[model samples]
Target: MLLAGAAVAAIEILHRRYDGAVARGTLLDPSARRDRTDLDGTLNYLLVGSDRRPGESGPDQRSDTILLVHVPAGTKRAYLISVPRDLLVSIPPAPNGYGGGSDKINSAYEHGGGGEAGVRLLSATLARLTGLRFDGAALVDFAGLRQVVDLLGGIRMCVDTPVRSIHTGRLFEPGCQQMDGTRALDYVRQRYDLPDGDYGRQRHQQQLLRAMLDRAGETNLRDDPVRLDRLIRAVGASLTVDTNGVPLQDLALTLRGLPPDGLTGVQIPSHPETIDEVSYVVLDDGGDQLFAAVRGTRVPGWVTANPRWVTRL
Candidate 1:
């Protein structure tokens, strides 16, 4: 434990001095917030994957991927909800800098720079749509993502359906297996072959997450100090967390109790709907009830439908 502490501290210092530019602030005083198990409010986080790669040139920047995480207090159980980027909902653009009226949620990032503008738009939209207050956020780049995967050595995953993509050079046979950083990235990014398109991609990501968690549990960090240090450094550098002013040590302690099976991953309830000749994922009754439940800190009506997906309270 002492060694792990020292290693994490060293990495934090190095990152702050060199590669650190993710400034932390919030609508609420996150610094003063505590992760109370007794609180009725859900702990929400927005995970955005920016489409700003130099390899793909585009004037418009969007979140290629979006994940909303909700962790109820006092339980090891957690929920991850993936939002489709092309769902075509009204996105309130940045106020001053990127005023283009309501558009797709992805455009908010293009209007506002990748930093504060994007975060503000996302958080505000979430509050309006779900009536739930988000407590923190974590941002990561492709490089940071690669580092995290490598740190885990590799994650084992089972391919549910055949996913073949010529662009990303990914081909998977349906079965359980191990995936390295490169393969894992390709798997999560592949959407062309899947039947549900972006929805399928989200499912794949969630599956990978489950496999990674399982691997994380089995991993023995104390066996290799060098590797542990490398992982700690990579994770710290890769994530931009809005920890509500909570100390790093305290946060770590909070996460200590989480188990692999404790995580419940769900996609926001929506099916394809056409509007103005454009396809949109209109939220169904399930979606509305889910958000309502989140706001009320109670199980939504759809929760019963997804008995397998929702962790037991």
Candidate 2:
């Protein structure tokens, strides 16, 4: 799970209890997603992590991370599904009627005008690709990640492999350790040296989110008024979400009550392939089976059969 998508879940808990502390947006197009008529009662939220850096000027042209938060009909558990940004797909045209063709999935942002428009087009592309409808979407950045993690007094992350940050040269040994915001950002961005490369980074990203959710579960914010206020404010500003016209408070209420540790993270089965000298991810036949299971709200069954594909989050 990307920080932005994790922010969606975190904000859901905060908004449910605190009543209104998160920023909201109109980021989805009602007509863009698939009609929910044929599929099971599954709710999907598109969490997009924009590639804009801390000092970069101008709009984000690529999505560094893309995740789908899937809540099955009973809402007993949620799945964090990672979509590789380099996956090749046919992008749909923007609302303004410009730019649509076979391209990397991350390029949808630039092709769709780079803000809320980018989110809508990305959602549309995913909907067409997965035959899934999005109930909501969110755009989250890394700067807010620093604020919230620091505000919470940092998070505990267990690194599975030794990673040296490419950005800061900070060595993260293979063990569970407490990490501040800046270190967490740098750690999550170290993909090049990992064993599974980007897939390993995705797993690290997913674990960071689970840690945030877990740490937040441990804190009793109401007991500390000052921290509570600052934390709420930080969380509220970190996310820009569209609940597809559903009230944020109501959706939060509906989303609460799942076990704090019940999040399941999975990556679609794919392999890196070079097409015309350009790298792209091509999903295997198992991805089709996984999508079929998701469509029927039977991912548990899919997981049981394809256990290797499920990341232990």
| C-alpha local distance difference test of each model | 0.65, 0.80
lDDT of 2: 0.80
Across residues 1-313, which tens digit of lDDT does each residue of candidate 2 receive?
6999999998778657654666676677665554442223578788987766554434446777888888887667888989887888888878677668998888887777766787788888887788777778888875678889998889998888998888788899998899999898789878888998888888888887888888888899779979988987787766778777677666766766666678888999888999999998887888878778877878888887887778878
Question: What value of lDDT does candidate 1 attain over all alpha carbons?
Answer: 0.65
Candidate 1 structure, TM-score to reference: 0.81
lDDT of each residue in 181-227, candidate 1, tens digit only: 77887888788788877778887777666777787778898798788
**Residue 247, candidate 2: how far off, in angstroms?**
1.2
Candidate 1: where are CA atoms >4 Å away? 1-41, 54-59, 300-302, 307-313
- What is the Å distance of residue 310 in model 1 from its true position? 6.4
